[model samples]
Target: MHLSEMTPEVDTHTHTVLSGHAWSTLTENCLAAKRRGMKGLCLTEHAPAIEGGAPSFIPHSQQMLPDTVEGIRVYRGIEANILDHENHLDVPPEYLRLCEWAIASIHSHMFPEKAKKTENTETYLAMLRDPYIDILGHADDPSVPCDFEALAEEASRQGKLLELNNNSTTAHRPGSLPSLKEYILCCKRRRQRVCVASDAHFHAMVGNVRPLMTLLEELDFPPELIVNLTQEGFEGYLRERITRLKNLH
Candidate 1:
């Protein structure tokens, strides 16, 4: 249950050209995941976040894709923007219903008001409570601050995973190291589940979670708490996720 000499079997968060700001195609992303020995990756396109992000119809339309591509299991998914403090998502209900998996994230642009730290905490807690959302992407972002302890407690209660975004470990999210460490520590202390994601915007970066893994290794984070560390672990989580979606109203 350690990070050394081990890698997550699935890259839970990734972007394709369809996300508007990313540089890779779905095919390229899949190949990269396969090369990295990933059993699969979630093809999560952004919606209503970037200026030219994927259309609202994109999520439901993803059903056209095969379950597996390039020998890698492809989970049709969307990274929906959390538009406001009311817990509203940019992707509408109809499209949301078709998403095989979904990530709800707060981008800087999504909440220009940048509500108070307490409000952001509430917003995140609301997201974690959502049955449709499998994970909350990059809550460590300094821009949208949340109380890490509160997040850890709520995520544990909800039985959902919190994202450890590798993108934040790099210069992409400046000054994020402290917050990311706090997030890891809180989750570890609470014995909460998590998923490490590359958050790759390019083909070559798929499954590129080494930096975050290094951080986890340094913290001695528990591997059993990470849902994607092994194929069986991830697949088991997926089955639970699919069942959760089906049982939702």
Candidate 2:
């Protein structure tokens, strides 16, 4: 089926006002996702490590939200900052355990110093080693360069997903398409999981991943690799992850 005629069942990455920079409310985002025909929405606020990002209490209080919002399943998560090569995350392990899913990304503002490609790659490798990290968000952004091939292979081995962020590839992040295309190719080649995200800051942009969908279609990328296409697959990942966390206790 052509993606132009389809929308992802779940948008695994997004932000609300709690992120300190985004424009929407969690309720508004959920409404928009439902209106756009999405079965699920992951509200992944930026972790505290980010400059002016979410407060530590935000992730800790995720359970206060209803399981379903505006008739759509709500998955609460965090876009955690990868602090350094040591794999330090902005959120503590206790808070990380509270999240249903987690997407780790390197925000330059969070780092004390500039990191080279080798350091960036090593940091991500370390982050993926943490089982709480379920997806890698916007590795396509050139500002935080890393070895996509290495990341894709590691994500595959760890059963983590690499995101194809719509905002990063389209307008917000410039000069990212070439690298994003390469990352997608690497994921396709390694048979790794991929999540298409709008990374929407506003309510209207939720579930708006048409650009990445078109690109995936152009590449003839297999649908099976795209986890957002099926609601069962998307939500199943969270359920399985939560279960794994419980088992670990």
Candidate 3:
């Protein structure tokens, strides 16, 4: 399905007021997404990685977020932090099990230097092999020096989705364009599918994949390869991925 036909895009990664650093409420974000014509959105709160992280403040309050909002489906998700060289999650597996979907990513605390980048990449690759991890968030962000080609190939082999994050381009980690380009090229070469994430910290940013979406188009990316273009397509892809991961474990 074409993205415009899908309309108001399905954003799989977003942050709400519950995240201390974020500025908008969940309802506000839902309303904004509606205005932007998004079919659905996921509220992926931060999963605490280190001693201090945004997720540490909210705790596991999935029950606090309604199942639906303003006629749009809102999924409860968590961007779990990779806290160790082993690529272990900071949030307990029990808490993680409660989420409809989970995005695992490396943060500064876990990836400190260049050598750590290689280690973190291997660790993330291992997590991608995990049945429960639905998406691998922002693999190209410069803050973590993973080899994009290797990561993309691994994701493709495992059938895990990679993210082209808008926020990674804007703030969370700046000056990431080159690395992002490399990652995109690698995905194209491997025929790997990708998901675009807003990584929004406020309501206004909820459905804004324009910047990265444009980049994808510029690179001549085939829209059919993006798993989230349609609800059924995404679910099927995710289920198959989960099964694949489960077999690995």
Candidate 4:
């Protein structure tokens, strides 16, 4: 099947107003996702480390939302920040443990040793080892380059997902196309699982993953390697991740 013919069932990365820079509310995001034919959306507000983002209690607070909103599932989750190369995340383990889905990212100005690719790669490689982090958010930013091959291998070994962030590949991170393409190629080479995300900060952008899909179509990336490509597939991955997490504890 052509990549154009299939839509990712879930918008695995998105944000609401709880994430300071975002412009929409949870209700708005869910409605948009549903309108765009998505079966679910991950409510991945930034963790406390973000200057004007959600508090650490976000995970506990997310439980207040219903399992489905505006007729589509809204997975309670957090986009936790990778604090250092020591596998440390800004949000504490207790709260992270409460999240249904979690994304670990290195935001601009927030990551130390920023321009150092070696250190950056080490940081991401370490984050993948965290059981609670389901995906690594937006590693395509050119300012923070890392080893995509290492990341893909690590995520595959751990059965985790790497993100193909639409915003980063398109508008958010300029000069990122080449790097993002490289990242995708590495995932394809390793046959690692990935999640195609809008990384939408607004309601209108929810489930808008066309640009990345176009790239995948061009590369002939395997749809099976993308966890959220179908609702059943996405749910199955979540179940498997849950079982794996359970084994860890």
Query: Candidates' TM-scores?
Result: 0.95, 0.94, 0.87, 0.95
lDDT of 2 at 175: 85
Show where candidate 3 strays beyond 4 Å. Answer: 1-8, 50-60, 113-115, 241-249
Relative to the unseen true structure, what is the C-alpha lDDT of residue 98 in candidate 2, on a scale of 0 to 100?
82
Error of 4 at 181 (Å): 0.7
Q: Tens digit of lDDT per residue, candidate 2, span 50-71? A: 7677656456478888999999
Q: Write the per-residue lDDT of candidate 1 for residues 1-249, one digit (tens) a residue.
A: 457566688888888888778998888998988887889898888876557887554664687888888999998888888888889988876676687678999888657867578988999899888887888999999888879899888887887889999988899888999989999999999899999999889998898888899999999998889988877888787787778777875
User: Pairs clashing in candidate 3?
Assistant: 8-37, 8-38
lDDT agreement with native, every candidate:
0.85, 0.83, 0.74, 0.85
- For residues 177-222, write the lDDT of model 3, one tens digit per residue: 8888888888888888888878888888888877777677778787
Model 3 lDDT at residue 176: 87
Candidate 1 stretches greater than 4 Å from native: none
What is candidate 3's local distance difference test score?
0.74
Best-matching candidate per TM-score? 4
Extract clashing residue pairs from model 2: none
